[model samples]
Target: MVDADQTFVIVGGGLAGAKAAEALRAEGFTGRVILICDERDHPYARPALSKGYLLGKEERESVFVHEPAWYARNDIELHLGQTVVAIDRAAKSVRYGDDGTVVHYDKLLLATGAEPRRLDIPGTGLAGVHHLRRLAHAERLKGMLTALGRDNGHLVIAGAGWIGLEVAAAAREYGAEVTVVEPAESPLHGVLGPELGNVYAELHREHGVRFHFGARLTEIVGQDGMVLAARTDDGEEHPAHDVLAAIGAAPRTSLAEAAGLEIADRAHGGGIAVDERLRTSDPDIHAAGDVASFPHALFGTRLRVEHWANALNGGPAAARAMLGKEVLYDRVPYFFSDQYDVGMEYSGWAPPGSYDQVVLRGDAGKRQFIAFWLKEGRVLAGMNVNVWDVTGPIQDLIRRGTPVDTEALADPRVPLGELAGRD
Candidate 1:
């Protein structure tokens, strides 16, 4: 048990850090807690930045998790615009940027999250090329979108992942001609598999969004410090006024390594390794959210999830463990994305090449359906596009490791709840 006045220092004031701090206080700990964030603003939801927030449909004040006054009331110190440079485990303190202030902590939570990856191709440093990872990036992109009016400019997205596709939908909604360049055969092929990827390709194409699959980009070309076009490996050029690189993000783990903590092998790029209790190799320190690469019960191997759900759900789990509440973080992974008018929801674990049977429910032609992935006889995961009700039953089946009848799942006449023996 920790002393009443023991300090808890949390790095990276994004969703994970913010939620962890709140959870610690809610758990009845009156200990001193400090949250360090590089950004000036308090914690705000990021998922809306690509959708409602970027489109100007949602106000910034509405997206903030809590007002600045709330932090004051809770006695949680907010270190805005402060960057933690290194962690000295031996001294039990962290070094921040030029402030000469070393924060001492009895327990430390590293939620230092991830940043969007950038392409190293030529002309990447051009004025019109940008990566959407933070609120500042979204604000800049929103301004650029306003400058380029309807049917006047073209926006080229570098990747076909969720971020790139969501941005593509938003750009299209703003009346800009949009094109997505993907090196794979289909969008989200790496994650959703080819069948679901085809559905996404069809959905985007139906909305007049152009996709160049199996095309490898070689370099970005610019003139007068502004992006102009992207050249492919096949000697083909595509014109663009603005370029958004939504390839993916990498974990911010430099401080953990600098502190001489054991780093885990990279599952999805290079993320920090942690146990089921969210404890790092150093027992005094814990890692959560996008930075922590954790072992999945379904996959039988460590994996790193980039969804907002992971950050929100996993952060508190780590905090509880630090407070001596022993529990394994085994919640089924889930995420949602809003693209155009479609809302896609996914749950459970789907390891690559682990599924033998795939059951499709509802009508994809009508733009509403759910796809269930089964390994052997048990349900492993399910992806629902514009179908929200299917998530609950699928999640239950995944949790119980229940064997679903493929025939019942594929038939729209039968309710999904009946297949899992829930109803």
Candidate 2:
């Protein structure tokens, strides 16, 4: 039933791709495994790029998913710095690199990941304009932050999302001036909503970070090919020596699109549409991580998560599914953020309009609390700030899908386990 002569080709060199290769081997697959990555660097986790590494608290080597020698030892054919230009689904092969070399595969996996969205405004091409996505980008930004810190330069950031806010915290730690321009009224409004978003706003404000809310960046004013200021649509100019665009990232779907794969629409988080088994429209091909939008039986909707944990768990699950193992990926969506002195972990999906009420546990003023978004009386999502070791219970509350009492949920004396219908 198993073919040793078969070859499994994986596209994309991010965390998901690398872990899939590891899982294939762990699953006792003896077939040839080829992993192609456009980046020359080894497969690395992305969280560090915006957090520890950017803050100079993590070593460069700590970001890699595996040691450099691990691939060779595992017999994985790693094609670093190579781009797969085209996929031939009918031929079961891919055209890669400038020479157009083709590699055939019996099975394929796409973990192509995403790229930072670019600013269409003027002066984006100028010096001192930066984005933090790749390790190289973090390295460059780290150097820039050091220079800005040393010279007391003002760094203007566009977007108040996770990346923008994390970078702002790192900039403040480096003693650089930071001004964040966000279209939303509060930081993380799209995710945490206004109530908790205001908490982050206050946290950053306490650290001397300036926020210009309810405005979009109109242009990055520059002179002599270097940033000078950022102008907002509200006709206000914010002085700056550098600009960081943390607007967000868009899924890289060109290869899948060209191959005629069924891609999910924007309303469902645009990505290659995959089934519960991570199988795409083409049965021979599969997708995982940020690029694959798959149905969540628990959430009752198709979701595409761009966080590190998805890649950490999704790859192995996809690999097992490829190995003819029964797979049902219903893991609760999870993500965490660290800004200034506050750290938080969020579980489940509770976007605006999806929840009826937000209940709080512990102290909000002290930045130590758990915020729960409830639909009717059922727990939909929970975020713990400056709180530790409650991710398990929070996820349990969401997965159980049972109504929880707000009074018991808010009472600090009540054990979280007792509230989640657990013994």
Q: Whose lDDT is greatest here? A: 2
Model 2 Cα lDDT, one tens digit per residue, 182-205: 998899887899888999888899
> How big is the positional error of residue 207 in model 2, measured in Å on the Cα after superposition?
0.4
In terms of TM-score, which candidate is strongest? 2
Error of 2 at 315 (Å): 1.0
Candidate 1 lDDT, tens digit per residue, 1-423? Answer: 876879999998888898998899999889999999989989876898898898888987876777889898999999999999988888889888666689899899999999988887888889999899888898998887876655479888889998988888888777777889999889987778777888888888988889988886678899899988988777888898888898889888988988877777765446778889998888889999989988877657787888889889888998898898986987788989888788988997775587887778888787698888888878888888887777788888888785767787788889878777688
Residue pairs with backbone atoms closer than 3 Å in model 2 (clashes): none
Q: For all the candidates, what are their Cα RMSDs to the real structure?
A: 1.4, 0.8
Which 10 successive residues of model 1 have the least lDDT summed?
262-271
TM-score of 1: 0.97
State TM-scores per candidate: 0.97, 0.99
Stretches of candidate 2 exceeding 4 Å from the true structure: none
